[model samples]
Target: MGKVSSAIINTENVYGDLEVAAKASGVPVKDVDVDILAVHTKYMIGEGEIQSVEDLSIFDNDEFFLNPELHIEQSYRVRYYDKTVTEKTHLPKIAIASNKTLTKIRAKILADSEVRYTADLADELENAINRTLLKYGFLIGVRSNNLKNEVRRVASLIRVNGALIEDVIFDVAQGIEPLEPIDDAMIYHYKNKVENADDPNSSVLSVVSENETIIEYVKSKPGRNGRNLKGELIAVTEAKNENAVEIKTTEKIRKEEDDKSIRYIAISQGYVSDEGGVYDIKEKLEVNSVNLKTTGSIEAGLDSDVTINVTESDVLKDAIGPGMSIETSTLNVQGSVAEGASIKARSVTIGGLTHAKSAIESVDADIATHLGTLTCSGEAKIDRLEGGSVRARVVNVNVAVGGSITGEEVYINELNSNCTITAAKLVVINQLRGRDNRIIIDIMQTPEYAKNLKVYTDEKQTLGRELHKLKANLQDKLSLINSNTSSVGYVKKRIEELSATGTEAPASLLNKLKDYQSLVYEYNTIAKHYRTQKERYDEVIAILQKMQDMIFDSKVVNKGRWVELNDIKFELIEPRKSICYVTKENELARVITIRHLEIAGEHIYEIKKSNEMPQELL
Candidate 1:
């Protein structure tokens, strides 16, 4: 090839609507078709400036408006570039050749001009070499992606004006060395990726579901011998790898073999563990303790079919260290949990004290001592609680101290410290040893009560007003229609009489008839509106009353004697909270009762003290 260069034919553009563009380009209306890679459009936001891209997605949003004009500058890229060397002056001498068998390809930039390289140029170089290889008996052994990469390297060196690349080895080989394995081996394929522990988002413990593919086994086949350029058979002198091994999995990992291949699946959802080159999915992972050095973050997940057990139980060490989180199907801890440590599972049991800053969420929880945030959907049994937030459905505590307890039903054996207790239906305290306590009969989230009740109450009032107005409006319309009935009858009779004599009725009589018909239609519409609004008002009133009934079912009771110096306050948290009562400075009582009632449109909270406990607060 001769010296080469790339050139653009023209840069002119024809821009306008269909007819205007045809006229500008001097093309006939029927032949005004234009060929372009893309239509350039501008999208603007507000009046400040035009913000757009070649992509039309930017203008797809309703916030951006289309501009009338397109951008003037057109971007261009070189697709195929090449230059032939024509007696180059101070450049390095180029060299290239084919081996005796034509089974190797080692070459460099043997041309002159080279700049930006592209896929087209890479294809040209590969196709030329393929033709030469096809002429002989040798065939290409290097992959297509790798071959193109090497071809582009030639352009890379020319663009940098750098030193020559070594041609001693096969850069893009015509045929790789012919070899065969001495013995066949089993190849195992893992389904999941194992990431490094240092990666913050890395899930070092790969999890798998029951009967899921954890490893696949396929028999390795020996490579076929190759032929040289002269059509000569080549022997397999050297082996790729002489190692041959068989699969050996633990009892937890089940292996199934078919006619085609073999696959190892997990018996249960668990962590992928390996031992002595064998694969096994451990259903239960037991560790002494969880910390940065032991287990960075054990997150097997709630549905991962894995169980985590922390066995360390001394007071000095935490079962789960600071900032450690364990999410599994089942969790058990024998020792205390440290600050910033979290445990989440289907069921959690902590045998030691929980740090104040940590948080635990589970379906069922059993903690010896808690000073952390524990939220459960099922039940919680705590030995001692102090200065932490606990919310569950049914809470049973032996002794509770300075913390907030919320549930559907709460039972505390002894109230030894100041605490805030909120229960939806019932609250029972066996003993009140300290003071400054708030026992609230919580109306919030009391199924179909609280916010829904308020909504229905307001709706009932509005509907009542509307129904009254509609009834008055309907009556007025009916009265107007009745007053014009006789006039309408007289006008219709006069028209009929005139028609019998073959005479046209006066326009005044016709106007009176039409006015009466319009009044009747208006009256019927108002009557229907009044009836619908009255039914809706009755429905709203029923719903509001039902909600109020549910709210009153909640109660708070003190079962044991109230300490002499203790101050306990009872509260009801309805939409409008009501303070039931606050005991005297040195109040003494056996069993106290607090109830909510609405009499004469007033919320009456009654505090009755008795020696007997309230039966409803059981």
Candidate 2:
């Protein structure tokens, strides 16, 4: 009997449903008998034939077969609770039992203690050293040869006993050690901090400005009296050399009223023309050519057309003529601006030329010129101006001087002047209401200007009479209240005297005392009413002052417009006329209602009954 293999069948040896089991097991589903085997086993007291065997192995020649399948396509299945086959790893088995006794003693010691080690413990120690490095988190830096010594040092510490390395020791030597898994947040934060602190040449500049501008300085540098070019580069203006350019405040050229007095006066020269002045000279003059230059003044004399060229130091009076040309580079002085003379100059001096005695005078300038201080003995007129300041005794213009003009009586149609001025009429101006920043007083002429007069006849008379009447009534009431209260004290004393014997006070005396009490209460009421009336009387006097203040503070009033009291409060509500007024107190407490009327004048109606009217009412 050599080792034999056979597929034995026993019809009576089936355990589960044979057909269903065969179908599930991917074998032929035909009803076939399974193999039965007789074995002596502890599970069965009496050994007989075992019913079924789950696994069937059969050998034919040298090949082995598990279960014969009927279907050509086979699907394998296994049933178990959470059946998972363990994957075989190529990692070698850790054999601590090579020196069994020593390994057992070490294991026993470690089990009772906190230390533990595994097959890749040495590799873990090496990785810890690399992990401690701040830059090793970067893939390139970690693989670099820079941290090789550190890794080797950490590997040497992988002994069975490294004095039970405490967390504090590791914290001091290599920072917080990264254990099994590194926390992403801690790693990222530490990496950023370390990189920021380590980079020496890392310099950055940040600027914020709504308007575009350039910075010309920085606060710190690198050496000697210098600073650490570290910290934030907030603004360059704090550090290096300051190269800010300062603006020079030279005179800004503004449009000015023309100042040259070129009147064609007909003077009585040589008895030919009695009124012949510059007009006679102008008839004989001819313009050679009109050439424009920047400097000097032009004066057309009797026969030549004047072309003025002002220089740094030269007077134009001697060199000007009709049709004659004068040219210079720098302007030092402008020719005398006199009547009957036309002056075109780089600048002008009006100090020598007195203003014309004409009712109206006009001056015009095309280029830059100055009219120093114009003293108009009478009156003058001016046209368009480019620049300069004018101070005139009496200045009047056909059009408004667009620029500034300072004068005693300056008349302008359209211009912006910045100064103290006194004019009979200032029609159109903006921000003329004095500003606190600038010292300017705009005293507009009041429409009811007559009311501002200092005549106090009406006010004094009215106030004096009211004050006298109020004082008299108040004094009389005070005297009467004092008399009645004194009488009440006397009556009380008498009643007490009568009741001294412990008997009730005489009825007559009690009646007299009750009368005194009534008089005292009436006195108090009258005193309170008089006080209120006195206060109201004072208010009537104070209202006049408030009305004056309203003329200035309120725009509606200050605009010099007529505003009736009805416009202030549009709707008027009049109390119902004497329709048996009902009041909270039925003990004859009078119900006074206010009735407002808006007629031609403001009036208030009193709806008091005839009996309730004060005896003092007229």
Candidate 3:
């Protein structure tokens, strides 16, 4: 018969469903025959076949059909075969091999033979074997007959000769000749003999010579003008053995021998000695300039200039010895500065507290003190001041209570009662309370008036000097005129005598008369000019006197602000006015209403007698 044409059906049912299988195979069910044998073996043995849709119910919906071959070789059968055989045979064979397997074999061989294999050498061997097999064929067949014999020979050689096979294989694969093996014992013996001969190139011999030279050089004396092995100069000096050598240097010496000896001022953490005098200190005693923590007090000798710093709870107890003040160059102290000491320095800073009776004088003073006196020429800052006097160019106080403060500019954050503050230009107080607080701000002299005063004073002095010179000139002129008057009188008397005789006057008398007349006219003219100058001098004197009086009248007029006040009544002394003395008999003083007391807000009050006080007063 001719070839039998059939559709291979892939289905999941045990009984072949021909219609579903035909649909899955894209064929008409009636035109194709059903084959149950393909379905029973899961399409592995043969293609499947199904008869009708009812047959699909017996199969799971998840079951899928794989694409089936139109023609499968049902007559062929696979047989057991070894992959190592490459010769042609009745069965096809597959070779199982990889780089990992070859690497493991190489490692085992190297371990057994006491031989080492680098990664490069191992990789080369693996590549040669794998390349040789892959190039021929992984499956043995008739064309790979010679290759099969070569692989079997290499495997047999490696199994029998072990790692020695690597050398032979490497030489064959890489086209290199085999190297001869070395005798380790004989090599070691020769190496030892060569080292004992003291060759210059040998590291061991060089090290030995170097050690001996070092030992000999250390034992030898350090001679001057000597050359080392490298021909370098070597200097030597004779001296006794000591722990350390001290070389005296004068590079940074600050004082000369003729100058006063230096002294060390130490403020330790204990009670201080009261020995009053300068103490010689061989070395400069250095202290930290920052916040220094201490526990006790500090006492210094008389006339000592020192810089002291302290922190924590400590006080400067002793008096800054009598007849000795801190120098203007040194002397600095910080922390709790106690009383009974007068400190004078360039600058003084108290970080903690400043007690009473501590008279601190400096160019600049900064104190976080409660109550203390500070007299600084530059600037002063205090934290809380009470019942003390502060005089400085600029004063800044956080809180002031019952103190007298005087400065060019005074700034107070809080002002309590009974504090007398005077500033030349400004007095700024944020919160003002309590009664009897006197805040006086002196209005500075106006620039215009100041300039005028300077000009007027200069003019007055100049005019005074001119007046003195003019007075002297006037006196001299008067004396000369007086002498000429006597000459004129004598000439007139002679003229009169000649006229009474009824005779003609002589030429000598006429000449004398003419000369005397000329002198008189000149004297009168000078006297008239003198009177003009005298009038001018008198006018100038009057003007200068007026200017002097104006300058004297230019006084500092005080202005102030009582921002907030308590119920206590206080007196405000008006500027340029005398203090009003209130008494029972002084009715005029009571009647006089001074407009200086200006209440800022709307407050109602009544002026009552000193004896008649209201029970409820606002």
Candidate 4:
């Protein structure tokens, strides 16, 4: 990257067409372009002055043309002579040269309604000239830089009225062609570009259909006045028929009761207007025109722009304003709607469920479920509900359902009863719905402790097996001590008598006495019981741990799509003496015998079955 700067003064050199003037002046000019000759009497002078007699001496040596009225006219005559004739000579008569200069005609113009004149005046003149030139089948004019780039020559000084005057004069170039007017019936495939409507490069104008069928149908209809394609009103065939006119125009419409006349005019290129407003149909009238009487009552629209007249025969269903709602049993929605809540006695109706590609908002009954945005001012209850189910993103209620709940998000304030609930995540306020007509409160969990409990159960089982083997070994040790105790007791009695007699015992005698005294308690009470107690405790801990882990795992079951009581981890609240009325899944299908019960984890118990065995009752 290098910084480069040069003082490059680009002066616009005048390459004017001056050679023709020099040739006409008979000056035998060389490379004399863009030069102008000053007219002096009958002679054309170059661009300088010759003042006195001494100044005239140069002309004597050059053999210049001498004019008799040179002083009278204050001009000189130019002549051609050979060098041999070096004296002052009389100038000859010569044809007067025609003066040629660039024609600089300019006009100030405002580019409002007068924009056409400002831009196309020169073009129009050029067209006319070229049309005249077409007779000769030839074209003339310089293809200058001015007209090459579709340049718009703007006026430098604008008038107080927003008018500007142009400075440059442009001539149409040779070989320029005249453009043909576009055919009204020309087929133009629309490419949908607004900027290219007047493009010089475009051969034909384009048109596009936004609502093609609607436009065509409107066109096939009629306008307010009975005008034909040639815009002439003809006599009507059906005189008795009040004119049922189809309006299509941009112009303001006029309706008069005097002549029963209604006018439809097209003012803008696109829009057409009747007595009501502008329309866009380029067609004639279908219905005849008639006077419409004003209804007595007028009501403003929601926006207050459109005023609708209410007649005596008209019916009013509902009217909604700001902070105003007309409560009705039947709520019909034809389009997409976002609402805070809905409470419909009959049903919430929808015309199109396309927007709900995956879901719809509806409820058949208080219990029967579909997708519904349910809201309750008071307590909401459903006794026997059935259907697919509804899962609202938001569920605010003091409510109860005899149905299952499922959706992406589920939240409830206080749910007193429910059949089934399956959700990804659930948050409840106050109390959650529970099974068997029971209320459950404050269900919270911690992940780490649950994991540790799992590990503890596994380790406890291993410890239990080791304790059982250790207990057996202790039993064998106790039996051996019992068998050796009597022999050892005889040895201990002799040593005790000798020591009491004040005699020193032998080394062999002392060793034998010490060994016998070690087993003197008859392999009995304390040692054996201690080992057995430790084994029992280990076994109890292992069983309890295993049970706890199974309960914890089942309490939060998340698998296999549908979960049943048998599928979850189960513990018996009340133990039965003999298992009867057991199902195929090894679950008790009946209470069998009644007892006070308490269970740790979630469980299901069946009370009665449709079929009963005669032998089971006995």
Q: Which one wins on TM-score?
A: 1
Scanning candidate 4 in windows of ten residues, the lowest lDDT window is 288-297
Pairs of colliding residues, candidate 3 = 16-50, 17-50, 17-51, 18-50, 18-51
lDDT score, candidate 2: 0.28
lDDT score, candidate 3, position 18: 44
On lDDT, the leading prediction is 1
Q: Which consecutive 10 residues in model 1 have the weakest lDDT in total? A: 72-81
lDDT tens digits, residue span 361-423, model 1: 998899999999999888999999988789888898988988989888888999976788887
Better of 2 and 3 by TM-score: 3
Compare candidates 1 and 3 on lDDT and give the better one: 1
Please give, for residues 441-500, the per-residue lDDT of candidate 3 as tens digits. Answer: 332222343466566557657656766775676677667667777776777788788889
Candidate 2 differs from the real structure by a C-alpha RMSD in angstroms, to one decimal, of: 33.4
After TM-score superposition, what is the CA distance of residue 190 in candidate 2 from its true location, in Å?
Answer: 99
Ranking by lDDT: 1, 3, 4, 2
Q: Higher-TM-score candidate among 1 and 3?
A: 1
lDDT of 4 by residue, 1-618 (tens): 012111121111111212333344443334221211111322223433543332322222211322211221122222222223233212111111111211111122223323323344444333333223222222112122333232233322222324423333334331111122221121112222223444432212122222321111111122122211111222223223333444343322222222323323222222121245444433211111101121111111122122111112111211111111112233333322222222232333332211111222333323322223333222222322232234433332334444444322233434444334432223222333333221111111223333554565566666567667766665776777778767667767777888899877778878866665554443454456556767666675765545443322212111112112221112331231211222232322221121222468644343232222234222
User: Against the true structure, what is every candidate's RMSD?
Assistant: 20.3, 33.4, 44.8, 31.6
